[model samples]
Target: MKFIGYQSLITIVCYLFFIFMSFWCIQDLHLERHLKMHEMQGKLLIVILSIVSGYLLSSFVLSLMDSLRDLIYIFKS
Candidate 1:
């Protein structure tokens, strides 16, 4: 029970961390030339892309960790 709660907390933290990192990384890109519309739209696009890519990255990492942990069961009785 407590372990599950800790896992959930870790998952949330990992997701937020990755999303923040992605947003920071994406901010460095000069994408103004690509957007013909308002500047706000470009920023919005960056936010959307950051969330998407971050979620994907975090999910991949967490799943990989879980898979590796599961391998221990195979070696056990």
Candidate 2:
């Protein structure tokens, strides 16, 4: 595969891993009690929150790594 393909593959894996971790961790929060809506709505809210949090976290980590690599290249050259 090309470099772009490898980057895409890594991104997909990172997103999936972070999303699963966020979902698992969020379950312990019991956010359902805070919601006044139906059970379905509460579950939907949890899912949305997990996705948002995971995406943000994953993006930050990826960007930070990329930035560090670039910085290293600058010093090396």
Candidate 3:
């Protein structure tokens, strides 16, 4: 089996964390019986946006690291 690099591992972990957070937020919203409609909607939107933003940030970081690794490999070779 091939070893996964630290950047890839961190990216996967961040993605999973964001997914879990988004689902937990949705479950909380569903279970809250007293929240007004507008408030619930706002919270849902925030959670969704946060998950997307987090994923994007993680992806960007991963890509940057990959690029750096490639550059170093090229220079070494």
Q: Which regions in candidate 3 have their CA more than 4 angstroms from the true location?
A: 5-8, 16-37
Clashing pairs in 1: none
Better of 2 and 3 by lDDT: 2
How do these models rank on TM-score, best leading? 1, 2, 3
For candidate 3, give the lDDT of residue 60.
74
Which run of 10 residues does model 2 get worst, by summed lDDT?
Answer: 29-38
lDDT of 3 by residue, 1-77 (tens): 23568656777897877666656655554533555456667667767766786677667767887798789877786
Worst-scoring 10-residue span by lDDT in model 3: 27-36
Residue-level error in angstroms, candidate 2, position 38: 1.6
Q: Tell me the lDDT of candidate 2.
A: 0.86
Candidate 3: what lDDT?
Answer: 0.67
What's the C-alpha lDDT at position 71 in model 2?
90
Clashes of 2: 0
Candidate order by lDDT, decreasing, is 1, 2, 3
| Best candidate (score: TM-score) | 1
* Count of clashes, each model: 0, 0, 0
**In candidate 2, what are the lDDT values of residues 1-77, reduced to their tens digit?**
59889889889988888888899999787787776677788788889988999999899888987898789877787
